[model samples]
Target: MVESFHEFVVHRSPALCRTAYLLTGDHQLAEDLVQTALARTYRHWRRVRDGNPEAYVRRVMYHQQVSWWRRRRLVERLEAELTERADTDHSEATTLRLSLDAALRQLTPRQRAVIVLRYYEDLTEAQVADALGCTLGTVKRHGHDGLRRLRAVAPELVDATAERSTR
Candidate 1:
């Protein structure tokens, strides 16, 4: 267990940032999400420190992301870094990443959360449902719809022949 909130942030911020970025697809929004989540975690530190504090922070982030989405404040901004072609060797990988990012943006916030939590974070349907405060059926429906949209939008990123996990 982490002894201090600072220690927790130091060790976990990178993973939290990755999850936040996956959820928002925007660095600024991702940063904001993580910061807000961390702040909330700090407030409830005593209550959650003995338990799964990271999970607590993540739950806060997911709920906060949904709240931000509902307020129509999640306006995606294109960073200048995206337009620069500094590395030609990694262009293929970059293309695939951008394609996936675009495809994710096509999903609703809930669907995006479901996909990120299920695949990126590698959570089960039940865990994802619990995290998002929804039913398992809802998670499954969002996961199904989200994947179908991804296939339609970016078939190259998602292999059609790849078998999905039974879980």
Candidate 2:
């Protein structure tokens, strides 16, 4: 069991850490979050190993993210970092990616989590709700609210999409 768990962690850790980094936008904090979540998951391995352990760890990560947000006022500090860089390379796709990432950083942690899970991970509403331990309605509300906020902040994206449609 220990060997199997170790192997599982080795294989899944990168993806988990990537998700954590996207959720937090801080490498050190993401590492801590993933480590903490994995540790907690390890404690209940027997019960969770057979089930969707990835979902269990993701839930732990989401809860830990929320708790961290509540406990610290770090989001304000992050705003400056989010806007500090503007992608000015030749690649339009890279610029759009950077712009979208910056826009996502402006959202609240829960809203960001909802957006990441729904869009990046392409999880269904029920899956997102289950992962976040929220009701499906809350998941839908968060997704709606997050997109609304993103649209408000990123009118350029909307304009770009409109231009594409017309062309």
Candidate 3:
């Protein structure tokens, strides 16, 4: 157990921030999420000190994010104006990365959360289920459906050789 809130924040902020960023897909939102989670954790620090404080904070973040999604009526419109730059190396990897990002955006929040928890965070299905407060079957279903959607939407990222050979 962390002895102090300052120590806890100093030790766990980076990992928490990374998870927040993955969950929200926006740096500002990620930072805000982390701060909000940490604040909640601090309020309940004495209570959670005996248990897994980090897990408590992570749960708060996930629930808070889902709550935000529930309250959001308007779809976010992101318009980035990129200035033209000199020719830069654009490889197949870059193309695949962009495609994967776009495909991920198409998924429902629950499915995207499952993907991030299972793959990006390298958590097991059971662990993910616990983290997301769902059942093992639910996690498996989401993961399966999420992967299926990714394969359909971004087949090149899913199977590089198969795609390249067909081209």
Candidate 4:
């Protein structure tokens, strides 16, 4: 537990960046997201420092990513294809990671957030809902839809036979 805002940031920024990267798929955007969230957290540090500051920062990042997605909707850029040489021996895990990244990029912002929170962050449906400031039903809907889409886009990444948990 960090007592100061600076210490909190130093300890949590890497995890925040990873979450932001999972949310945005772009490194620059991820950095900006974490920075924006941290700035907001700093503003309320006096009030939030003694509480769950990391959760507060994550909530801010998720909300900010959604807002940024809305603004970028009209001017979304065409991403360049990932190129791989046949001669280069790539590990299966690396291939899966790349595939998952691409698959995640296809989801809507809310769905992507749901997926990242639920799986990458190991957050439960209730936790995801709280983080996104949404209902549990909304979280469930997005998670279901997102998983369905991921299976369609990258079947190798998501198992076809796995059942969605009711919890």
TM-score of each: 0.81, 0.84, 0.80, 0.84
Angstrom error of the Cα, residue 66, model 3: value is 1.2
The C-alpha lDDT values of all candidates are 0.84, 0.85, 0.81, 0.85
**Model 3 vs truth, CA RMSD:** 4.1
> What does candidate 2's lDDT look like per residue over 63-115, in tens digits?
99889888987644323223334653556675566667777888888899999
Q: List the residue pairs that clash in candidate 2.
A: none
Per-residue lDDT tens digits of candidate 1, residues 1-167?
34598899999999899999999888998999999999988988989888888778888999998898888865564442455556655656566677788878888888999999899999899888877778999999999999999888778776623423332
Candidate 3 yields a Cα-based lDDT of 0.81
For candidate 4, write residues 3-118 as lDDT tens digits.
58888988989989999999988899999999999988888889988878888998999999889888778544334345678887687666667787888888998999999999
* RMSD vs true structure, all candidates: 4.6, 3.3, 4.1, 4.4
Give the residue spans of candidate 4 off by over 4 A: 1-3, 74-89, 159-167
Candidate 3 lDDT, 64-161, residue by residue in tens: 88888789845753332223567965667766655656777667888988998889888889888878888999999999999999888777676885
Which consecutive 10 residues in model 3 have the weakest lDDT in total?
A: 76-85
Clashing pairs in 1: none
